[model samples]
Target: GAIVWVHASQPVQLGSGEALEQRYDRRPGGPRIHSFQVDGGPNRLIEALDKLPGVIAVPRLGTVEEDLAALVRRLTSGDPAPAVVRVRQGAGGAERSSEDRTAPHLARLWALQQTQELRAKRQVRDAVELAGRFQLVTPVSGAVVLENQQQYDAAGLTPVDPQTVPSIPEPGTWALLLLGGAMLWFGRRRRPR
Candidate 1:
């Protein structure tokens, strides 16, 4: 929903005049990373989106408006792809140079596993991994929230095979209307008698 900036690791200058995202460091005096600003969530909402496949956005019907929720795909970045290493036969195909940029995935986990506290090891690793996964980085996933359709004169969005937004009754108003109708019916009956 907002532009978020994260610092890129391992110093490497981006190609001059590169397009895609406009890098920014909203934090004062923070290291600037490549502006890979994707449509991501902020905080808890994003957290929920990241963990689950999707989140349902129920419509707010306080105003009795006909609102529509459409399925739309948002553009966002996911985890970086791993480098594929291939072997070359000797002379004709020798084992080519290997560049292992990433640390073994399980090293930290193993370290936590080896701690003095045996029972705490798994818990520690799990907690650490989860934190590391969500920390700082923006999480992207399928999220269904009340569609902002009112903007642009509320006519810009057209949901495919739309479902009608049900009209929900205002509690006090409905009760009062029913009471008034009942009183009128009773009064009419008395006059006839």
Candidate 2:
């Protein structure tokens, strides 16, 4: 599969104190639109369209000012933002504005928050997978040979020894542990005093 590298430059602080940036991909196809977001200090919530695959390499673009500007224009020009536009209205009265109407700005904010939460969950899952992989021994000889031994002897290399080991317990083990702990607590509570 062809890999796309989407890169975001260091965010530029806007006049309104919001940091903005353009994320672009450098694949065989033209640059793809990633996302933009308001900076709520260091841990700003970023809203993007989709997640990248493991093998994809997204190279960051140097200048994000143009992209940021474009997004801002699109957002403030009365055209609703994609993710939270539905929150603004429902069924029959989609066009009717009400006092309780959720502004597009607020909807965008909520969407950004949701996006950040999704990103965090993905990071946690990735970390857990990496931790599990770390416990297993990987063959490094092949990688070293392919990287550094372009002209060196490749036929006399000894095969890597395979160590037989069981895979880690499924995450269901954690759920069972929690369930047991809850049951123990309830049993204790039901006892005298």
Q: Return the TM-score for each candidate structure.
A: 0.18, 0.18
Model 1 per-residue lDDT tens digits across residues 15-73: 43212222211232233222231223333332222222122232223322222111111
- Which residue runs of candidate 1 sit more than 4 Å off their true CA positions? 1-155, 159-164
Best by lDDT: 2
Per-candidate clashes come to: 5, 7
| Cα deviation of 52, candidate 1, in Å | 27
Candidate 1: Cα lDDT at 82 = 36
